[model samples]
Target: MVKFLKITAAIVILLLLFYFVFFKYRQIQANKILIPATTQTLFKINVDELYKTLAVSYLKHPSQYAGTDKNSIREKIADLNSGLRIPANIYIYALKGTAKNTLFTRLEIADTSAFNHFILKKLALLKKDAHFFESADSTFGLLVNKKTVSIAFNMAKEPIRHILEEIHDQNNMVKISDSKFAQMASLSDHLSFQDAENLSKINFTDGKIDFSSEFENKWIEPAAEPRHRMLNPESTLSFWLNGKIKSDLTEKNHTMSLSLLSKDSFFRFYQDYVDFEWTKTVTQVDTIVGYEYNDDFEQVEKKILRDRKIPSITINLNSDDKAVSNYLKSLGALDQSTGKISSAMIPLYQFYFRGSNGNVQLSTIKSAKPDVKRASSDDFFYFKVDFKKLINQTSIPLIADKLGTFSQLEIKAKSIGKNKIKLESELLFLNKDANALMQVLKVFQNGFKSALDLNLSVDIPVSK
Candidate 1:
């Protein structure tokens, strides 16, 4: 019970109540659960890395993890290589010989459509006094006997009396050349994000939620509002998020822009407990990042930038540097320093090669309008967005049905001695501890006067 209370800390100040360790994110961290944000990131994992991850996991070869389709190779890549480039004249074999090259060099007849069309043009040119030739083998060429036979390869057509003949085929299939498939596995076990980096987006299909919270007052009696409230009314009521309110005892002059990437309803139910009403509607979606294929076929991706005015909630911050909080304001280092990301970078970049490679990017358009206003002391700058992009999938990182409008997310677990097992679960927008999060910080704002101020700090006292 004591530990439970510590995990659910609350601090209330006059006109403001700032909860620490926003329970949503905190609880998420505890859960070690991950969700991908499909709209604002780019991931280019080498195909080899996936194969390696699965190879080391169990008795089965991990090649499958990388995106191989052949069951015979299972997790083997001994012979397959992504770096090998093929020419237009060449045909690839999925499996070894039967007839033909099984695979062949680019045959003149290979590009049947283009060849037929070319022959038509050639015939027209011949009638127009173009010279024709034949090669030593009697095949038609630019010249007669020493000429070449360069007609289109489609025997199923008229105008060109021809027989279907395959020059030769190569014996090739997805047979791995080497036995040591583990050589090409992913070296890194964990996915890392950078500082000032946002990650793993989640979506709540319907009635999904999102939220952040902080805990305060671990020692106070359960649910006992912290002591800051009596001194600063603004601190206990409205949070700086809605609109800043004043409190003589509270620190002032602050600026902050926080983002919550989650299923629209990740924390909605919690807000419900607090009687907080929130709304979200996607106004406009702009595609920002698209692929510019280089000569090598490597993609130079442009990031997507979306302009969304989370309307209803006021955009009150003076950017990050100029702040209303004395602590933040006094810092000269907090200048309008630009970080790495910008207009050129792709915002919502995701790669899907599990079946076939695909890309999707979306930006928020300027046409979007959003407004958030606290009707009275009871209201906060509260809004909800189901950031979950349902790929018709319930699985992570894998879109199950390429043809269907859904994505599957499958959670798997393993105990050292237990057989590999997959689990089924669905995420929703409800917070079991929402009442605890709202208890963090409340806000009271008067557009004319500055809003309240309350410093929230969350400290966890248990070992997971």
Candidate 2:
């Protein structure tokens, strides 16, 4: 009994060792395929890991994960798994050539015939006699081989075929372990992207999609001062630039804001003040007398109201140098009296000016002020858009329908190292309980449905 127990333990240990060794080998192979020749934009995804993430997310919120199409999505994934090799990394990269950049998708395949059939069915293409296929518009091309599949966008068929052949023949392709951007591949569980000077990683959490990018350039310098205090929380859109103005050759920081008067007033304000060239169809009725029988005839004429939507915008400048401020005042652009600057070019709107001695605020609305304290000193560039407010205020159905999922988008860039600047952006979702990736899929599904509805509603004139 002691010997048997010892033998059983030995067998278990051997099996565990073998499993880990094989896993490590597969990982190394997968990473080799992810390495690109040129340092352009490259996206890598581990299909097996992503599905595992989806499974956990589904278990957390089954009903809200992907809604009723959850099963459909799983079945489609299964179909793909049967053809393509799962538990492997797939890459989509842009190959930069002399003239232009070509986008290529490279993935390992398990069953060539099955994947070919899958592609044909999904693209609604008939089975061709050759292994290579191109779309009718020459925008998409596909090449299939025994071990791998290559897809190119906006490229010709011959290039993709040649690329596939070269990839197969190349024995000394660079491995991800030996590449400079290898660290980015490990940043995210499922997705990572790298470019010439930037490396980005994306993570899909429960509520929000987190995207972080690092810009590695020696020319990036830290901001001299914090400018976040100039931004208004109530503004629908805000942007800040902390640098010198080339035209005036002055070192000035600028902040711009688009503040809505009220939630209900945005559409009306936009139509009245913002859109200067917008036109609306109107019918005009005119009275006319018939020449032959003395009968009264009503003549109708269509008129267009050529008014466009414009929002009241505010621009604030902060600088220690008074050159720009003095120049604007001298040019009659910044009036010191009555705190109003007349708009000579655009007669419809006038500007309100306040402040002097380098710091200034110029706005179309008299009540607009730059007293909001929302700026971060660490960030040199900051931008924010309130999608929720825009969706609530807009009367357009398409804009509201498409952008209803997002609440706010905020992007910030800050210096992290001597030659590195980290960019962080968050896309807040309305549904906090569901997974962000699942919500993205739902958005695409809804987009497709909306497109189909639009196509069906279009009136086609029948030719006789």
Candidate 3:
């Protein structure tokens, strides 16, 4: 027992030592990138890493940027390393004063030796042609220090000098070794300045951005709430949003491409309203139609009509459900009987069956028939959108004819794996070989063909 206890105590001591060492290392690393919030908004971006990532992506898929002159592009990219002294780190701060908001950009240049030369060049150019800053020429000035060059625009020279003095004297400038913004920058290639308060509210991992409730209330709600009730002030939009360009392969099998993924939390409010329940019921009905109850459809339709609390009225001419069509015909919901569906039923059909084969058969309440033909597709998995129907439903005449010119859009997606889906989307033109728009399609097709050819053969020179 004594020997066992001694061994256990030794193990515990080693673990405690390891824990302290790890904690200390993490704290040191965190402190290295901690920056102060000097203004209402502060953004820190690592230009060196950003340029490197872009260069690698461009090398991998040189064909994507085909329209541009290749030699010129190479020269422009090379300039990043050629005596340009591009800042390793960039910070843009927006100072909100009582009178106005002043915007200042600070670049932490890698080499200070070329700083004076660069400033002199800018001053010489400004002297020759002051038209570049004719609007606020007097306010523009370059302040160069040990390793940083700060440029102030749209502000008086005295104020700019005073601000610089404050930064130097009070040490008010946010440092990458001390600010939360810098910590975030260290994790991601780019960061957007939201607010100074509550840095913990902004969480960054991989490429995903997770915001706290305060962030959602401040930024997201105001912009999205007006358009859709699904994204209300009370409703959650997305817990995590990620949009990143990958040069190297990711778990999702993406390389030299852009990927966007978001985790939506709107389903939390699924039971908040009757509309949501009805939507769920409609989805269940669709699933039932697809997988089971082909024979019971007649009984279902009859029961729906008899009950008058119709689950929903849907129009799908491709549907072989004679029972549902017959029931709608009996109620004058479909135009099959009298060559027109009633206007009273139009709104309900529009609400339930969003996308249909052609123009939504709409008529006045007093009108007996609709002039438009009813069409539908039999593909259960494929979604066909008729732009003409959408435009007619909105009744925006000015754009109606223009929108009607667009043919049907088909979108289909199939899950290829547990976390991957292959989406095939296409827009079909109504005019086939005759429309002038076909020429535009040909141009795009030719360009894509050229790009594919280049992708197979062309080699892009990547800078170190």
Which candidate gets the maximum lDDT versus the true structure? 2
Clashes of each: 133, 10, 6
Tens digit of per-residue lDDT, candidate 1, span 92-122: 1111122221111122233434433444453
Better of 1 and 3 by lDDT: 3
C-alpha lDDT of residue 213 in model 1: 19
Show pairs that collide, candidate 3.
32-177, 34-178, 34-179, 35-178, 35-179, 335-340
lDDT value for model 2 = 0.58
TM-score of each: 0.17, 0.68, 0.36
The per-prediction CA RMSD against the true structure, in angstroms, equals 29.8, 10.9, 20.4
For 117-151, candidate 2 gives per-residue lDDT tens digits of: 77777564443446677676656766766887666
Worst 10 residues of 2 by lDDT: 269-278
Error of 3 at 231 (Å): 14
- For all candidates in order, the CA lDDT equals 0.24, 0.58, 0.37
Model 3 alpha-carbon miss at residue 244, Å: 33
